[model samples]
Target: MTWVGPSACTLPTVEQPLRVAEFDALFAGAVQGVAPPGPRN
Candidate 1:
């Protein structure tokens, strides 16, 4: 599973859909100004 070189590594097609889902979750969280619970200004 290692590309291990000076070239690009390609992810499997099966994993492409999952990438979209991951991006969607991130986008939704950002739109809501979601942040890790911590000290704030």
Candidate 2:
């Protein structure tokens, strides 16, 4: 069986925990300055 979703966004080995505020900050930062690779073109 093959499946892909948000859960597949990362690898299974490393674990980088993030706080809600930290995540919100990162998301906001991305929107403000950093340009993500974004969806496939």
Candidate 3:
């Protein structure tokens, strides 16, 4: 259930939550949407 792959960011495990919080705060007002899964090629 990890949010990203090992190379996604340099933050250590303990610091990830803080980074997530920062993103959440910055994007709080962003538009929200979802798309249905597309068929596999």
Candidate 4:
């Protein structure tokens, strides 16, 4: 994946897929809903 800015991610490229899978599992188990962003105050 292409990272855009200067803040470098510590995760190595080889392990990125594992990290993505971990996030997918977490979201599948924990996320309850999806909503659009509300209007700015």
lDDT of all predictions, in order shown?
0.62, 0.53, 0.78, 0.73
Q: Among these predicted structures, which one has the highest TM-score?
A: 4
Off by over 4 Å in 2: 1-18, 32-41
lDDT of 3 by residue, 1-41 (tens): 65667789899989988888887776676737657899989
The numbered model that scores best in lDDT is: 3
What does candidate 1's lDDT look like per residue over 4-23, in tens digits? Answer: 33234365767755766777
Q: What are the per-residue Cα lDDT tens digits for candidate 2 across 1-41?
A: 22335465574434323343466677777775756697997
Q: Give the count of colliding residue pairs in each prediction.
A: 0, 0, 0, 0
Model 4: what TM-score? 0.59
TM-scores of the candidates in the order shown = 0.46, 0.31, 0.50, 0.59
Candidate 1 residue 40 Cα shift, in angstroms, is 27
Ranking by lDDT: 3, 4, 1, 2
Global lDDT for candidate 3? Answer: 0.78
1 against 3, candidate with superior lDDT? 3
Worst 10 residues of 4 by lDDT: 1-10
